[model samples]
Target: MASLPNRKIAAAVVREDAAHRQRLLDRAFALAFKGLVYAQIWEDPVVDMEALAIAPGHRVATIASGGCNVFSYLTDDPAEIVAVDLNTAHVALNNLKRVAILHLPDYAHFRRFFADADDAANIADYRTFVAPHLDETSRRYWEGRDLVGRRRINGFARGLYKRGLLGGFIGLAHLVARLHRIDLGEFLAAKTVEEQRAIFDSKFAPFFDRKLIRWITDQRSSLFGLGIPPAQYDALADGKPMADVLRARLEKLACDFPLDDNYFAWQAFGRGYGKGVAAPLPPYLQEVNYAAVKARAERVTMLHANMTDMLAASDAASFDRYVFLDAQDWMSDAQLAALWAEVTRTARAGARVLFRTAAEPSLLPGRLPDALLDRWEYRAEESRDYTRRDRSAIYGGVHLYTLKAD
Candidate 1:
């Protein structure tokens, strides 16, 4: 697509010699379930639910990730939702939630399916419980016959969680921890915030912030293990001391938000959070939304496409809100303009768009046409509050804007 000058922004040069678009399922299937990714039902507090909380009749579209936010958004009574992602492992994880949330009968079973997900019962649970409701691809993904983990939702059972690039990162982390004479198991067990902080600030802080440790991890090759593309690393390195910026971000993660509620922080520090062998749960799991997730599960419809492309296929001005997440960082300027054109085309009047980025801004003024940016109102204060409140602490900042319905 010989698009536009804005396309320059989309041309994010990645430093990936090893990882390319592989067949998504097999890649995910083969990647052993190592517990690096969150697999629970908690929603991220960074997403401004109030922005997305349109009238019950409105529709929504968002990146599904592990499916936590999908279910969480459903609580707002959107007429329908389409959650999309490019990662197959992420898709499979969402499929797993689809079956469990919509059909598993009750929250207790739900709890076991996710909270105690590593339990022995999950094998039969997959075959007899969640398997049938899954789509053909998803159904094939869970059947015990070909799975690596005959029991561990097969994701955990097959060691698939341990095998992916992210899993390898966890393994590397464990090795580094061992070398330091630190037990991750002990850190995860810390019952008090003081205990967690004490260990993190003293033991983990040096690991992330020191020059030597920083030098190694900041390299293009080292980050590939975590599935970070060269482009992402380049974006991270944008005219700044990359490691210093990241260290500051991690420190914010440790100090800016409460540990108990910020599960994404757990992913970086402890590897996983929530119950049941650490499924990729979201922040909403902390309380009342548990039942809400169960009840709202049926309302969601999932898809496989780019966020803007998928929405482009829909009726214009149909969706009341948009959750682009961090995908825009992968986009060039023209792609963003094209995507926003779709967003502006299909987004209802007064619709809100929420997203995150490695850098700390709305990202439109530089890349997007002035007229379009003019129509939206950036809730700078709200963005500041939500971004600061982001318990994940992993991202740099959260940005919010309201598209003028007029």
Candidate 2:
């Protein structure tokens, strides 16, 4: 498949002998993201809220993945949020969420439309309240039929969580587990973390040791559903058996957080949020934050462009908070430098930037130029603290960088 225009930015960042491999990976990632890959953003917003310390005066710029975090940030009442993404699908999803927040009848309707998405009434709500308000691109995206002859919006009526690439990936995992006579769905039945750990140790943990499972995981293509690129896979696979690394990560996901309140766990294990379990809802989907998000929906501006391009065109000191969301892992030294140059140029006084890494250490020090990197203070201790507290335990590290005082 041809790579999308927005993905060219990711392609341009590769300056290594592995550029050919990287381009192929980027193409796969682009195709994966061309549809709804993330039913929900994987990054934990609670850690973001703490690290960014968003105030009413903050103007934020972030990469819009599934737009879950973008909407979550709205509850903080930031001055403005510029949500940029190269993928048109992500841009459309972000716009759809923003419009739904503004036009949806109530919090209950909102939750039904997105969270408990298997109800037929969600399609009705989309047409009645959200469809007319959608831009032409988003309207077409939602209304268009997919390979199965069902309109994309119909996924809401038929379980939206089970439609996207990530959803398909989870389904594949379930199929494989079944082949091993292990049912991952059983993980959802645990009433406490102890049971969760017990289920994982006995059932899930043994699957990773299977020769078939290990062989399948060793293929880099098998992870396209997770949105990991070739370079990222290399970073993740560094000096470790891929299956073992994955087993440990899944263990963290299964055991580290209380399953009752970890939506990521629910999505991974049960394939959807369990019925009537409202506590695990994403911040934007939670009732207490709904009205605040709706009121501030207009504060967000969605842009279909590369983050580097978007920041390069902006005025100096324009944004106060930057959320990179693991994008830097794909960058080369030159690309990282160019991005930080723009970040440093456009960042307001005391501006803060946060990003995640596939590896444990921050990527900036050796890769980015010192003149650019020196101006920012790395919040090493705070970042370690936040990473531990992050309920979404997929990432290796979460980092925070603050512009030094003038």
Candidate 3:
């Protein structure tokens, strides 16, 4: 038998710097990984899978969340991908998955890499097929196994990481309610679809507008774990004293799409692991990505720096597609312009740039001048349809754009 191999660190662990990860997660919102501290993912875009009809050699850059859509997008087989994120843990996970897909030998090994709980065979598989390819930092990262001794990757198998800050917060609230003889999670996890509706209407509906819940959620400190900064907390809390937008978002989580097909709902309330056969999956994670997914692990350059900084690092007329993925909502006028200048410079003329926001309106209109924003044609109808059909989402909307004809 061969010895376990040392892991390789791809750029996916690009933001492994402690200070950078701290600024994003511990400070932004009190989010955790494997019940530790992953970044907050509230109001994240429901990535437009339909819009991801990749050309033969499209180079795409996307935000690396837990790395779901990155794999989803790969199902279309882009030429390359640049997945940037301020969160190191997320980057690490992306690298890990990409490597797993390439190294795991087959789909079953891939399933064991992410969805298999902490079984002896699973751990052994990690040591054999998976661990050898992981970079040193990532190897160490998974070895720590958190305080719970549950390997972080296996947490995905255990359906833990999918439960983001919002998911955990929902769980905490459900627990609080459970103490008072209310079982919010249980009621939502009804065996039948109709019973689930009854629970949503009778049990979960009132909590959306609860004053105490609003008060706690509105506090920046209270949301520290969710990784929202003081400013973002203020923005998300809406202008009123209570959390109106939050209530709406939560209501959407409960009622937007039927829970049967929506994986986000499973993570939020059903506490399910969407790790079965690739059939019931987002586009990126399907079997199409299995064979070639790891090949692009190194191709994508994950960075903690702003998109503008990333643009400065690249050359002109380079990327065929630039996917902003809602990062522009955090930009200032100068920042937006600077980022756009780089995007436009590196753009391959007809290259497309896409993004999303917290509301129906485009954040770029006032922030970015007309000429800069006009370079890309907004696919409003397509964005709307994608947003509506986004199944693995707890958020309300999505947006898309295509760069103008050269």
Listed in order, each prediction's TM-score against the native is 0.81, 0.96, 0.79
lDDT per model vs. reference: 0.63, 0.86, 0.58
Model 3: lowest-lDDT 10 consecutive positions: 2-11
Give a tens-digit lDDT track for model 3, residues 1-406.
Answer: 2111101111111123446643454332323322333322332233554565567688876766666666656656677778776555666666677767777677776655554332456667777877898887767776666555656656544454444454466567667677656665575456566676677777766775677776776665665444444434444554665356665665566666665556566555644434456323444444655656555555555554445667788888878776665555444467678888788788886676666554555666677778888787878788787766655343334666677886
Model 3 misplaced stretches (Cα beyond 4 Å) = 1-47, 116-120, 145-159, 162-170, 187-195, 240-242, 274-279, 287-305, 392-396
List per-candidate RMSD values in Å. Answer: 6.0, 1.8, 6.8
lDDT of 1 by residue, 1-406 (tens): 5233112212322212334642232233223222224343223533557555556887887887667677767666677778886555567778778777777766666666554444566566666777777888766544533333443355543334344456557668778877877666566566667776787788766776556677786665555554444455556566676667766766776665555656665665555454443344553453456676666676787764557668778887788788877767666677788888888888787888888777776677788988778788888998887877766665666788888757
Candidate 2's TM-score: 0.96
Best candidate (score: TM-score): 2
lDDT of 2 by residue, 1-406 (tens): 4456545644643334566776676665655656677877789998899899999989999999889899999888899999998767678889999999899999989998888889999888999999999999889988998777889988889898887888889998898888878889988889999999999999989888889888988987778788777677777787788899899889989999998779889899888876784548888988888889999999999998889999999999999999999888888787899999999999999999999987778988888888998999999999999888778787888999999998
Instruction: Judge candidate 3 against the unseen true structure and give its global Cα lDDT, from 0 to 1.
Output: 0.58
Best by lDDT, which number?
A: 2
